[model samples]
Target: MTHSEMITVLSQRLRWPEEKVSELLSVATEVIGDQLSEPGTLSLPGLGNFTSRKSKEFISLHPETGERYLIPPSIDLFFRVAPALKKQFEEREEE
Candidate 1:
C-alpha cells in the first residue's frame, strides 16, 4: 500500500493521530537506513531481518552495442521473512 494508506491504518490500529503515525514511520525508516548503512542486521520479532552487504565490482556487456563496461561495487539491502510469517502466507495461498 501507499505511505498515506499505511499511516491511516497504523493510526487507527494504534489510536494515534495521523501526523504522529507519519512521524513515527519517517523516523523508523531513517533508523533502518542508518543501521543498514552500517552493514548490520535489524531484526523485528514477527517480521524478519533486514541486512545489507557490499557486492564486488563486475564487468557488464551491452548486448546491442557489444560494448564492455565496468560495474562499480555497491551496497545491497535484503530482507528475509520470518518463518512464522512465511507459514501464514503459505497457508493463505493454499486456501
Candidate 2:
C-alpha cells in the first residue's frame, strides 16, 4: 500500500493519530536504513530477514562491441521471507 494508506490503516488499528503513525514509520525506515548501511542483518519474526552483503568487483564484456568494462564492488541489500509467511502465501495460492 501507499504511505498514506498504510498510515491510515495503522492509525485506525492502533488508535493513534495519523501524524504519530507517520513519524513512527519514518523513524523505523531511518533505523532500518542505518542498520543496513553497517552491513548488518535485521530479523523480524513472522516477516523476514533483511541483510546487506558486499559484492566483489568483476569485469564485464560487451558481446556486440567486444568491449571490456570494470564493475566496481558494491553493497547489496536482500530479503529472505520467513517460513511462516511463505507458507501462508502457498496456502492462499492453493485456494
Best by lDDT: 2
lDDT of 2 by residue, 29-78 (tens): 99888888877789999999999998889999999999999999988999
Model 1, residue pairs in steric clash: none
What 10-residue stretch in candidate 2 is worst by lDDT?
Answer: 86-95
lDDT of 1 by residue, 55-92 (tens): 89999999999999999998899999999899888888
Summing lDDT over every window of 10 consecutive residues in candidate 1, give the lowest-scoring window. Answer: 86-95
Judge candidate 1 at residue 17 and give its lDDT.
100
Model 1 lDDT, full chain set:
0.90
Q: Best-fitting candidate, measured by TM-score?
A: 2
Clashing pairs in 2: none
TM-score of each: 0.78, 0.81
